[model samples]
Structure formats: C-alpha cells, structure tokens
Target: MDDEPIWDVDRVVALTPSSAITIPETTNEFVIKGNHLTLIKGNQLDGRTKTDPHKHIHEFLRICDMFKYRDTKNEVVRLMMFPWSLTGEAKTWLDELNEGTIDTWDEL
Candidate 1:
C-alpha cells in the first residue's frame, strides 16, 4: 500500500498515540487526542524536549522516517531541517505554510 501523505494538521492528528508528529514550521509542541490538537509551550511535548532547532530536526527526521534519505542535496528538507538559517520573510512563509494560508510553495 502507498503511504498516506501527511500534508496537513488533520492528517497528522490522525496518527496513533504512539506515533510522533512534527511541525517543522513552528516552535509550538503538539499533542493530539481524537482529532483535537493541543499546542504546548516550549520544545517539550509529553516530557520529550529538544534543546535546539538542530536537535528538533533530528527528532523530526526520526519521526518522519526520512533520516536515510535526508541530505543537504534536497533543498526542501534542508530548509525544513534548519529553519534558523531562514530569513525573516522565509520564516513568515513557513508559518503561512503551516497555517494553510498560502496557496503554493512559490508564494513563499
């Protein structure tokens, strides 16, 4: 079976409790229960915390099962993994991406 695309918040919340979800665009930690998503403060979610964006990216990569395929050669992954490297406008664009406010990647 083909893997389901996790392209939005709803899809992410659909994951089982044991599954970990990451939102590369924001600093808020998320917890889901029966389609309801709660945003937690800081990098820790349920006692799991990341010290920095770099560590968070590592955690995200593990959750997404993308570690083997991730590299600097892929620009999108690079950007998502190192959000601290982005400019203010780029950060805003990523926020819009998370909110589903932008229609296309080109809009960033």
Candidate 2:
C-alpha cells in the first residue's frame, strides 16, 4: 500500500474525497493477503509488527479497506476480510502498491 501518507484510507486517497473511513483507535496491526485483510488490535499490536518483516503491513491492510468494494457477483467475500475473500482488483491498478511504492500516485 505504498507505506506513504497517500496510502491512507481516508484523507490519503483521491477517490471518495469527501468520504473517510473511521478505524478504531484500538487498531494497531493489520494486513492484506491478496484482497482480504486481517486486523488485530489491542496491546499486542507492537508485538505484531516486530514479528513481521514487511515494512508496512498495516498500511496495506487499511488500503485494502479503502479500495475494497463489492463486485457484480455480490459475493460477501468480495468486501469482507478473509484470506481468499478479496478480488485483488484494487491492488491491480498500482502494479505494485502492495509492494510499497507510489511513483505515480496522482491518479489514485
């Protein structure tokens, strides 16, 4: 998810300019595997990051939430957080945002 400020799910993205998703403060750790995301909050957050080598998994998780939406098929998995639930459509445009890069972020 670029791991930059622009990777944000609210004020960071261009789409839904006026819309901002409110994530709970308890949130400190999150991730995106394919299209699905898993969030683990609480005091254990700091512990979560230390274990994962990925620079900004949380950003990816949040970005997934921002770009995530229901597809034409209306599969509940399309907009939910399950390992194989995501469509991978949002991450496709970046060519490599999940890899943590946004060289041309203006189009977001």
Candidate 3:
C-alpha cells in the first residue's frame, strides 16, 4: 500500500555476538566427531512444546563429556557444541542475544 513504509534490510544491522563463546586453545587437535555431532543433532531443541529444554541441556552435557581435548577445558567444548544442539526458536533466540554478552558457559 502507498501508506505503508518499505523495509530496508541493508540499513538493518545484524546483532551478532562479538564473542559468544570463547574456545580455549588446546594442544591436541580440537575436532567435533561425526558420531558426537550426529547424536547432538538428533537431540536438537526447537523451543517448542513436546521438547524438554532441561532434558536437552542434560543430554548435551552428557554428550560433551564424551569428548576431551588437551589444554581445552570441558566448558570450552560445551560452549562450542551448545549451538549445534539448538534449532528453530532455540537457535533464533541464541542468534538474537546481545553482542559479546556470552563469553562463558555459565553466562550462556
């Protein structure tokens, strides 16, 4: 309609975090195994009914525990893998968080 204002995507800035998760350096190669990724992807959270957030968190932690990297803290692995465990609204919520707001697992 003539009365409606046009939306400008170029003028809009993406509010991406400067450092959502700070991954600690590791002496050994830090790689997310396909099996682990597959498992986490299988248990993704969509922030919808019928999906238990608490359960997802617990399961995520459990999967993270199965992975280990020298000089890399467990929390670092958790932080790196947490994003993969989300989808739909859950992923959208994480993406919309303020810049540099989350730098630690506790903060996340």
My TM-score estimates for the predictions, one after another, are: 0.21, 0.18, 0.74
Candidate 3 off by > 4 Å: 1-14, 17-19, 25-29
Clashes of 3: 0
lDDT of 2 at 65: 45
| Of candidates 3 and 1, the better by TM-score | 3
The lDDT ranking, best first, is 3, 1, 2
Q: Write the residue-wise lDDT of candidate 1 on 25-46 in tens digits.
A: 4334332222111111122222
The better candidate by TM-score, 1 or 2, is 1
Give the runs in model 1 whose Cα sits over 4 Å from its true position.
Answer: 1-50, 66-93, 96-108
Error of 2 at 59 (Å): 1.0
TM-score of 2: 0.18
Which residue pairs does candidate 1 place in steric collision?
none
Q: What is the lDDT of every predicted structure here?
A: 0.32, 0.29, 0.74
Clashing pairs in 3: none
The residue-by-residue lDDT of candidate 3 on 25-46, one tens digit each, is 5667767788888988998988
* Better candidate by lDDT, 1 or 3: 3
Provide backbone clash counts, one per model. Answer: 0, 0, 0
